[model samples]
Target: MARIRANGVELEYETMGNPGDPAVLLIMGFAFQMTRWPEAFRRSLAEAGFHVIWFDNRDIGLSAEMGGLATYTLNDLAADAAGLLDALGIARAHIVGMSMGGMIAQLIALDHPRKVDKLVAMMTSSGAPNLPPPTQEALAALTAMPMQRTPEAIADIAVKAQHAIGSAPNLRNSAEVIRQNAIDDFRRSDRPFGVIRQFTAIQAQPRWHERLGSITRPTLVLHGADDPLVRPAAGEDIARRIPGARFKAFPGWGHDLADAMSETLANEITAFLKA
Candidate 1:
């Protein structure tokens, strides 16, 4: 795990593929560490000839955590992402982000347009809180879970996560992967408060509809048809607001990456970036 002291924090990161290739940065969702981007996913991306970068956001995984909440807006997170690229001496790169990471990526594409060659927003929204929130069961399942060490608790949480995603029954099963991921998360970092701080920045963000037109970068919006946390409407809204943005939705994929639908997601991204 290489570490870079950047963006006012020492970020822990990992890189894949040839350093000489053009890059794509993979930004993960809330409470997820840098490693949350599955190695297979990275390998698939690297195989596509893009140097993929994955890193822990501040207070995640091996990154430095000053405890207490950060006085940061979502825009601050975007700046931090740009700072990461600067630290790595990257002038421009494709940006792919999921959930909270997607939000940050959107801001980056909007704020530092020249730095982004292409943008992929997955399972995320554009601070458009007017859309319906997750269903009551999904909201309770997602927002109520605690990050802890107990196997039973983690198992239960995984079950809830599975239910919330509402994966199609015919799809490849992801139960084991999801459970293993939760276990890894518990072992890696348990700073649930970090998620709270990040949510603080996310929830307080104003709608970006008026500003979406400024994103001239080619953009792709990927959403889970069955996703409860972030509805497909969010993706539709983003795609509609951003001129020329392409949107794709997959059945049986929820917010979680455990879905077997990742190949489809990766393929779409590869095609988009190559275009």
Candidate 2:
């Protein structure tokens, strides 16, 4: 783990693979720490001949947290990403972001075009009003009250939440796996307050549908057809708006990226970046 001062805040980040390889910057979703990127996933990308970089965004994990109300917009987050790249001495990188991170990636392409090479936006939206919203089950799971702060309680809640919004039953992520992941995540850091602030930041951002078309980078949009959180329509809409972008959907996947889908995602992204 390493820390660097970027965008006036200290961001905790880690790198994998050789520094001389092509760089891939991974931006995780809302309220998720850099660990959400998964060690195996990062290793896969590194093995594919890329230097993978995963970092904690502001107010999450080891990154600097905001002291007051969540006033920062998505653009601020995008600037933070750009600043991180500058601090790392990386001229440009393959920008990959999921959910809210995807929004930030789009903004990075729009607000700092030269800082991004290829763009991969996953399980996200363009924030267009007409897009389908989260399913009732997904909403219920998302809004469920936090469990007790104990590791066991947190792990149980995490498993339940994942089961609610995860891949179809046929998928391979067992409850044990989800529970262990939750335990590890909790052991790393438990800051539900930071999650609220991140959510607030998302709510405060403006719709970016009109601005997405302006992004000229080679882009790939991936979404789960069964995703209850961000519907497939969002990915389709984004792909339609971004000229020359490619869209792919996985049939059995949901809002959560289960272990079963990791290899497929890694291969797809690796191929896209290589192209």
Candidate 3:
């Protein structure tokens, strides 16, 4: 676990593959640790001849905390990512983000275009008004908090949430895998207040949907047809608003990355970046 000071905070990060290879920076979603990025997915990208980097966003995992402050916005989050590249001496990189991370990635492409080679937004939204809202089940699952901070309690909440927003039964990871992931995350860092702070930051961010048209980077918008959280139309809206952006939606997929979808997602992303 490498921790480096970037932007204004210390970020826990890890890198894979040769340093000489083209870089791919993976930004995870709201309140998710970098470990949530599957090892197989990271390894696949590295094996495909790219240097992959992922880190715990500020206020999550082993990264620096912001106390009770919710003053930061998505743009600040975007800067954190760019600063990470600077710390690593990377001039530019292929930026891939999931959910809220996608929103931040869009900002990077818009506000720091020189630092992004290509952009991939997955299972995320443009925060456009009147966009389809999450289903009741997904909404409840996402908003639910573990009553106790114990690993079992936290893992149970995560398991239930995954079941609600994850891929179809046949396409999802085994129950054990999901539960263990949650447990691991909890054990690594159980900062519920930090999670709340991150959520508040998202709520405080200014809407940037209309700004999507300004992005000029080669972009790919990937989503799941069954995604109930952000919804497929939200992803489509991003692709539609961004000139020349390509969109792809997978059937039987949902909000979370499952083992069954890893290969397809990796292949799609690798092809786009190489192109």
Question: Better model by TM-score, 2 or 3?
Answer: 3
Query: Can you write out model 2's per-residue Cα lDDT over 131-177, one digit (the tens) per residue?
Result: 98898888887767555788888878878788888889877478998
Angstrom error at residue 181, model 3: 0.7
TM-score of 2: 0.97
Steric clash pairs (candidate 2): none
The CA lDDT at 130 in model 1 is: 85
Per lDDT, the best of the predicted structures is 3
The predicted structure with the larger TM-score, 1 or 2, is 2
Q: How many Å off is the CA of 232 in candidate 1?
A: 0.6
- Ordered from best to worst lDDT, the candidate numbers read 3, 2, 1
How far off is residue 42 in model 1, in Å? 1.1
lDDT of 2 at 122: 95
Model 2 stretches with alpha carbons more than 4 Å out: none
**Candidate 1: where are CA atoms >4 Å away?**
147-151
What digit string (tens of lDDT, one per residue) describes model 3 on residues 1-275?
A: 79998997899999999999999999999989999988889999999999999999999999998887557888899999999999999999999999999999999998999999999999999889979999999999998988887888888888899999999999988889998999998888987888888888799889999999999999999999999998999999999999999999999999998978888999999999999
Model 3 Cα shift for residue 176 (angstroms)? 0.9
Please report how far candidate 3 places residue 21 from its true position, in Å: 0.5
Q: What TM-score would candidate 1 get against the native?
A: 0.93
